[model samples]
Target: MQKLLEIKELTVSYDHEVVLNDVNLTVHKGDFLGVIGPNGGGKTSLIKAILGLVKPSKGQILFHIPQTRIGYLPQINQIDKRFPITVLDVVRSGKTDRRSFSLFAKQTEEIAHAESLLNEMGVWQLRHKAIGELSGGQMQRVFLCRSLMNRPELLILDEPDTFVDNQFESELYEKLKELNQRMAIVLVSHDVGTISYYVKTIACVARELHYHPSNIISTTQLASYNCPLQIITHGDVPHTVLGLHDKHQHDHKHDHEHDH
Candidate 1:
C-alpha cells in the first residue's frame, strides 16, 4: 500500500479561468481509483495536471516513481483519428523514445513487445488497418495496448469507456483489473454504475474535491456535494442520494447553459 502519487492543494486553470480548486488526493500501488463527475467538472483538467500536460496553477503533484514508470491513455474523444496512421503504427508510436527504428536489430525486441500487447488487447488482427476505420471500442483498445507496451507501473486513463458498448466497457474494466495486479490505475469516468465493480476506491470531483474511501458513499456525503450524484458498490447500479426530481431540475439548468 505504498503511496504512488500524491496531489496536495492542487489547482488548475485554463485561459485564466479556474477549473480545479484545492484538490488533494493520494494513490497507492495496486489501487484502482475511479474519478467521477458531470461533464465540464474539471475531471480531464485534473488528469492533465497529474500527467504534467497542464501546469497546476497552485500546489503540487508528487510522484513516487523511484522504481516505477508512468503511462497515460487520454480520452478517446480527445484523440485525433484523422491522423493517417495504422493501428500497428499507433501502438508502435508508444516506443518512440526507445532506439530508432532504422536500427532493426535493436528495435526488434520492442516491436515484438508491442505486437504482444496488441494481441493481448485482442486487436492484433486489425494491426495493419487504418486507425480511422476501426470502431470506437477497437480504437480505444489499440491505444490501451500502446499504453501497456511500456509495462507501466502506474496507468492513468481519461474516460476509458467513452463511446464503447456495455460489453466492451466490461471487457475494458476486466482487463484493467487484471493489469491492476501489477500497476496502479487512475481512471476518469462518468459511468458511475459500473466503475465500482472494478475500482477499489472513488474520488468524486466537481469545482472542489471530495474523497470517499469506500465505493459505497453515504447520503450525508452526497448531500455535502450539493449536486446530483450517486455511489456504486459491489456490482450494484448507482443509487441516488438526492431525489430524482431535484436531479432532473439540476440537469435542466445544467443543459440550458450549454445550449447558450
Candidate 2:
C-alpha cells in the first residue's frame, strides 16, 4: 500500500520533560491504525503531532499529500448543549471545505451533502431537532456526520465510543469498517477489546511508541514493554495448571523489544 503519513524520531515535550520520545510510525493507504496505552502516555500527543496541533521538539513528519482533508473528533467535545443548535446546523458547522459562506446564498448542494451523511448515520429524521434534545448516542452520530462532512482522507477519532450507547458502539464500528474501504483511520482509546477487533493494526504508546503489527497482543507481551495495560480478551483458553510437585514462579523477566 502507498504510504500516506510518516513520523521519524518524533519527540514532543512540555516544560522540560518529554511526553513522547523518539516516536516513529507510518500511516499507509487504507490503514486503520488503533493507538492504545495508559492515560499519562503520549497517545494524544501523537495524534496532535500528526494533526499539526502540537509542534514536535525534534524529528520530521512528512505527509504524502500536502493538503489532505482530515476529520477529527476529540475525546471531549466543547459543544454547549444548552445552546439552540439543530442537527443540520451541527453538521453544517463542520463544512470546512467550502469556498465561501453566505446564509442567504443558495447552499442546496451543501445542504444535500449534509443530509446524505445524516441519513447514512440514521439521524436524518432528526435534522431539525435541537442538539440538546437528542440522546447521547444520537448526539454522537451527529458529531460523526459532522466529522465526515469534509469527506476526509484520514479520520482521526479520540475515544469515539465514550458516551455512546453499547449498541451503537458496535454499530459505529461497523459503519467505520465500511468507510475504511476508502479512507485511512487513526483511533486512540483505552478500550482494548473492541479496538483490537476493529483496527487493522495497533500501536502501543507509552513513554515511547511501539507499533505492534497485529492486534493479538498477549498479556505477557504488554508486560515486556513495561506497558501497564489491562488485556481484555474473550474465548475459551485453558489456564495454566501446576501439579502438586510442580513449581510456578511469579517473577517474570520482560524482554525489551522495539516496535520496528
Candidate 3:
C-alpha cells in the first residue's frame, strides 16, 4: 500500500481553454485504477499531465518512483502504423528511455524480455512482421508487449480495449488482472462494466475528477460527482445505477449487471 504517485490541485488548459481543474489523486503500489468519463471530459488530458506530456497550468504531480519506472500504452488509433517497424523492434524500443543497465547484458536481457512479453501477448510468431501489416487487434497486443518490456512499476493504458474483438477484450482484462499482482495500473476505459470487474477503484473525470474509492459505484454517486456516462450493461452482475436522461428528463434506470 505504499504510495506510487500523487496529484495535487492539478489543472490543465490549452490556449485559455481549460480541460482539467483542481484534480487530486493518489496511486499506490499494486493498485488497479479504472478511469471513466464522456468524450473530451479531460480523461486524456489528465493522463498527459501525469506523463508530463502536458504541463499543468496549476498544481503538481508527484511520483514516488523514478519516471523511468512508469510505462504507458497510448490509444492504438493514435499510432501511425506506416513507420515501417517490426513488432519485435517496437517492443525493444521501450527500453531506450533507460540506460542504466550494462550495455552487453542489457541488450541480451531486453531482447529476451521483449520476446517473453510478445509470447505472453501471443504475438511472438508475428515478431518480424511490419506493424502496418497487422490488424487492429494484433497491433494492440504488440503495443501492450512493448509497454511491459521495461518492467515498469506503474503501467498506464488509455482505452486499451478500443478496436478489438470481444475475445481479446476478455483476454486482455484477464492478463491485466495477472499483471496487477506485480505493478500498479491506471486504465482509462469507456467499458465500465468490464473494468469494474477488474479495477480495484474508480475515478470519473469530466473537466474535474471524482475519485471513487470502490469499484462498485451507485448511479446517485456518479450523478453527485457530475460524471454523466451511459452505463452499458450485460451479464449476471446486478446493481442499480441511473440511466442517462436527456433534457426531457424521463425516469429510467440502468442495471450495473456485467458479463463474467
Candidate 4:
C-alpha cells in the first residue's frame, strides 16, 4: 500500500537515439505491474534504468527498501550447457547475490529451504539432474526458484514466459499472483492481453511510456498511447489476444516500405 519505487523524469538514450523519453512512474507495495511493448520498444532500456544496470541519461529512480530486497530474472540466461551445474546448485547460487550471508558454508536449514522451493516448482525429482538436460520450461522453473530463494520484496522478471510452454504459462501467473500477496512484482512481456488478466496494472513502453491502471483495457485506449499491440480479450475463456488482422497490416506495411 505504501510507495515502494519511483521513477521521475526518467530518460535513457543510446547515442542520441533516445530509447526512453521523460518517463515517470510510481510503484507501491503489492503492486503487480505488467510491462508490454513491441520488440524494438524501450522496455528493456526502461527495466535496465530501474535496476541500475544502465546509467540513465536523465532523471531519478528511488527505492523505499534496501537494494537487497530486490530480485531480478534477466531475459536471456545464457548458461553454458557444459558448465555441469545441477538444479540444486543453480537454485543455491541465488544465495551468493546476498552479500550479507555467508556463501561457502552450507547450513542444513539452507538445504532444506532449497529442496522446498524446488519441490514447489515441480523440479524436486530432478534436483541432481544436469541443467542442460532439462527442457526450456523446466529451466525457467529452476531460475524462478533461484530468484525466489532470497525472499525478495520486489521481483523484476524480464519476459519470464519467453521459453515457457502453454501448461506452465497459467501456472506461472498463478504462482506470481500468490507471490504478489506478499511482495511487489514487475513482469515484462510481449503478450499484453494475456497478462492483462493477471496484472493489477499495465504499463506500455515504446520510446515513451503509458500506464493503464487496470487490466481491462479497450483497443482505443492502447491506440491513444500509440501502442501497436492488438489485444483481444474474452469474457469467458481466456485466449490469446493477438489478432490476424493486425499481423497482416503490419506485414503489408513492411512490404510497402521495402518497395520504396
Candidate 5:
C-alpha cells in the first residue's frame, strides 16, 4: 500500500512536560487505524501533533499529499453551541482550498459535493438550520459531512462516538468502514472492543506508541504496551474486559496499598 503520512520520532510537550515521546507511526492508503489508550495517555496529543495544532518538540510529520487533503472530525463537545454558523456553511467551510466567503459567492462543484455529503448523511433537510439547534447525533452527522466535503485522502476523527446514541454510533462506524474503501482513516477512541471490529489495525498510545498490525488485540498485549484501558462490549448483555496485570505490577500495587 502507498504511504499517506509518516511520523518519525515525533515528540510533543506541554509546559515542559513530555506528552508524546519518540512516537513513530505511518498511515497508508486504505488504512483504518484505531487509536486507543487511557485518558491523558497522549492519544489526543498525538492527534494534535498530526493535525499541526500543537507543534512537535522533535521529529517530523511528512504528508505525501497536501495538508488540505486531510479531513478532520473533532469531538462534538469541543464545538461551541453558540456559534451562529449554519449547517450548510459549516460543511462548505471544509473546502480549505476555497477562499473565504466563496462558500456562498461561488456556485462551484464543491457546493454540490457538500450538499451530496449532507444528503448521504441524512442531514440535507437540516442544512439551513443552525448547528446549535440540532441534536447530538445530528450534529455529529453534520460534522462528518463537513469532513467529507474536502474529498480528503486521509480522514482523522477524535472520539467520534462521544455524546451519540448506540444506534448512531453503530451507524457511524459502518459509514466509516465504507469510507475506508476510498480513503485512509485515523480514529481515536477509548473503546477498543468496538473499534476492533471495524479498524484494520490498532495503535496503543501512552506517552509512547505501540503499533499493532492487526485489529484483534489481547488484554495481555495491551498491558505489555502499557496501555491500560477498560474495554466495553456491546450486545444484549454488555460486559467489561479489564487489562491483565502482571505479578510485578500486582505486587507493586499491593505494596503501595499497604504503604498507604
Candidate 6:
C-alpha cells in the first residue's frame, strides 16, 4: 500500500473560472480508486491534473515516477468516430509519442505488443476494421487495449462505461480486476453503484475532496463525502409520512385530496 501519487490543496481553473478547489488525495500502488460525482463535478479536471495535462493553479501533485508510463482512456463519447482510423492504427498511435522516428524504423516489437493487447481485449478480429465501423462497446475495448500497450504502472480512465452495455461492462470490470493485480487504476465514473464492487477506494469530488474507504460507505459518510443530499427510501411510502418538507406543502394537499 505504498503511496504512488499525492495531491495537496490542489486548485485548478479554466479561463479564470474555478473548477477544483482545495482538492487533496492519495493513491497507492495496486489500488483501484473510483472518482464519482454529478456531471461538471471536476472529475476529469482532477484526473488531468494528476496526469500533468492540466497545470494546477495552486498546491502540489507529487508522483513517484519522474517519467511514469501512465495509460489514459478518455471518455469514448469524446472521440470523433469519423476520423477514419483502423483499430490497429489507433493502437499504434500510442507508440508515436514514445518512439522516435528513427526508433520506429524497425518497430516490429511495438507492433507485436499492440496486436497482443488487441487480442487480449478480444478485439483482434477487428484489428483492421475502421474505428467508425465498430460498435460502441467494441470501440471502448479498442481504446482500452491501446491504453494497455504502454505497459503502464498507472491507468487512468474517464467514464469507461459510457457507451458499453451491461455484459461488456462486466467484461471490462473483469479485465480491470486482472489489470489491478499489476498496476494501480484511477477511474472517473458516474456509475457509483457498479464501481463500488471493483474499486478499493472511492474519491467523491464536488469542488473538494472526500475519500471513502470502500463499499462499506455509510449514509452519513456519503453526505460528508461531498455527495449531494438525496433521500433514499427502502419501500414505497407517502412523502408526508417520510417527513420530507416541501415549500408548497404538496404532501399535505395530496393527503387532503385523497381523504375526500
lDDT of 5 by residue, 1-260 (tens): 79999999999999989989999999999999999999999988898888899999999999999888899999888999889999999998887866445555665777788899999998899999999899999999999998887689999999999999999999999999999989999999999878877887789999999997766666888988999987777853112223333434333321212211
Summarize candidate 3's per-residue lDDT along 131-234 as a digit string, tens digits: 99999889998999888877889999999989988778878889999999899999999877677767878899999999877676656677788888777755
Candidate 4 versus the native: TM-score?
Answer: 0.85
Those runs of model 4 whose alpha carbons end farther than 4 Å from true positions after fitting are 77-82, 97-106, 232-260
Model 6 poorest 10 in a row by lDDT: 251-260
Best-fitting candidate, scored by TM-score? 3
Better of 3 and 6 by TM-score: 3
**Candidate 2 structure quality by residue, lDDT tens digits, 1-260:** 79888999999999968999999899888888888889889888888898899999999899985444788877746567888889998998888777655854537767888999999999999999999999988888889889887888888888887888778888888898888988899888887766766777778899798886664455666666666787553332111211111112122111112121
Q: How well does candidate 5 score on lDDT at residue 25?
A: 97
The 10-residue segment of model 5 with minimum total lDDT is: 251-260
- Residue 71, candidate 3: alpha-carbon lDDT: 91
- Each prediction's whole-model lDDT (CA): 0.77, 0.78, 0.84, 0.78, 0.85, 0.78
Tens-digit lDDT string for candidate 1 (1-260): 79988999998988889888999999898888888887888898998887778999899988888422677898898889899999988987776445344677647877788789988999889999999999999999999988876678889899988898877888999899899989999888876667755676678888787876655444465567642464443333344322232334343321212210
Q: Name every residue pair that clashes in candidate 6.
A: none
Clashing pairs in 1: none
Superposition error at 126 for model 4 (Å): 1.3
Give the C-alpha lDDT of model 4. Answer: 0.78
Model 6 C-alpha lDDT per residue in residues 6-104, reported as the tens digit of each score:
899999999988899999888888888888877888999998898788999999988885334788999887899999999998998876346445665
Error of 5 at 250 (Å): 30
**lDDT, model 1, position 214:** 53
Question: What TM-score does candidate 1 get on C-alpha atoms?
Answer: 0.84
Q: Model 6: residues >4 Å from true position, as ranges?
A: 96-106, 229-260
